[model samples]
Target: MTAGGARRGNTRFVVAGLFVAFVLAGFVSGYASSHPDGLEKVAEEKGFLGQADDHAFANWPLADYAVSGIGNERLAGGVAGVIGVSIAFVVGGLLVFGAVRLRSRGPGRASAPTGDRGPDDPGPGGPGGVGTDAAGAGAAPAA
Candidate 1:
């Protein structure tokens, strides 16, 4: 496909993905169970739940899967989920951009190291590293 076509397709894909992410984070997350997860359940069953200390960021605004100062539990959770998803998307995009930028700034690389071979060096193809064979007829096209 053409570069423009490929870019348009990628854009569409990203838009669809973001739409789904936002929907799930802002709406579907509200229906998620509030019960303890496996780790918490296991601790509770083992009678060690009370021994667990609060997380370092337990007092953070988005801690406990809910945003602080929100009266509605579902809304608070939804808002937190959306915030988390948005933050993750932005962070991931930044990482990809940084990686691409770094790679572009590095030295250029060729598919094959053509410089190592001396001017007189006959490649694996014998005679001419490229072009015609010894038989006279054009080389049966490189693989």
Candidate 2:
């Protein structure tokens, strides 16, 4: 891999590690703010707590960030948190995968071969393509 590629991979790793650390800290410390969180606090201060109606899924599994029917609050909360993280990770991975797949192809075209080419190669912004100097005034300079 090029230095830039390696650097980007390392940066991603660091970010992922930090995310894991933060989630673990939240789970272990149970050190959330004692103050009422945003919506709850606003409702209380504005005397609009009654404005909020019970959600349709109020009794649904995973409601209130706890597993349904779990006897232990702490364990239920932890399991719910882990499930949330897992869902987030899967969704994020699928999004990135789809984006990469889409960008690997031209509009209505098959995926391109992943290859290194000279700077003169005619890509989407190359001399004859859209955003090329010959085609537009604000075209980007060739790399």
Candidate 3:
């Protein structure tokens, strides 16, 4: 396919993926099992669950898979899930942007490399080069 068609296809794929992610985060997460999983179940079965301490971030707003201050349990969990997904998406995008910017400039390069032209020089097409002028056609002769 052409470049524009490929780009549009990629965009549609990304949009569909994002839509699925949002739906899962904001809806399906509420249906997740409330019972403790294998590890937690084993701890409880061994009678050591009481001795376990809460996690360091246990008091955070999004802790325990639920958002704080929301009355409905399922709704709170769904909101927390969506918020978590959004935060992760934003952080990932920023990291990709930074990496692309650095790669475009090459290693140890801080600025783009320009042609070796001085202030008084008309190196390319001599005095009337290919650049726009006051009339927006060709470069004007230097004073």
Candidate 4:
């Protein structure tokens, strides 16, 4: 339990949250509210609902709530939601992992266990400062 892991949250909690998303996507999505959401309902009331056309990406395979060929709307929507949830989970996890790894490996870190003496701190050959001779002068190190 390092500092980073605590900030990120427990693994069990993360897995549980993802499982809940999967369940909702695979099952509860079929029962999602049928009425037009707030924006669509407002547009319809304002007499401009027809102005809204299909999404620009409508031709995509999962274009509509349902798959292209799936006749059963409920099943299609549920399946689509489940797939979307899985993809989101994987992508999100990968992004988090990459960020943490990059942060740890970034230049601010030091190879020595003492860790992060900062740019101004004299590196090894102590007190010479960078690119300097051991006498702490602004001269190159002696061969």
Indicate whether candidate 1 or candidate 3 has the larger lDDT.
1
Poorly placed runs, candidate 2 (over 4 Å): 1-26, 106-143
Q: Count the backbone clashes (under 3 Å) in each candidate.
A: 0, 0, 0, 0
Model 3 lowest lDDT segment of ten: 132-141
Q: What number of backbone clashes does candidate 4 have, counting pairs of residues 3 or more apart or in separate chains?
A: 0
Model 2 lDDT on a 0 to 1 scale: 0.64
Error of 4 at 44 (Å): 1.5
Candidate 1, which segments miss by more than 4 Å at Cα?
1-6, 105-143
RMSD to true structure for each model, in Å: 14.3, 10.5, 14.4, 10.9
Across residues 14-33, which tens digit of lDDT does each residue of candidate 4 receive?
A: 77887899889878988888
Model 3 score (lDDT): 0.70
TM-score of 2: 0.56
lDDT of 2 by residue, 1-143 (tens): 12225578786886687578547743863555557789998999999988989999888898977888888877777677777777876687687776554334334345347655757454665455433534334332331
Candidate 3 lDDT over residue span 8-39, tens digit each: 87878877887899889999988877899998
Ranking the candidates on lDDT from highest down gives 1, 3, 4, 2
Reference-based TM-score, model 1: 0.65
Q: Across residues 1-143, which tens digit of lDDT does each residue of candidate 1 receive? A: 12225578797887799889989999998888879999999999999999999999999999988999999998998899899999998898887766444333213442445667657433354554224333223332331
Q: State residue 119's C-alpha deviation in candidate 4, in Å.
A: 21
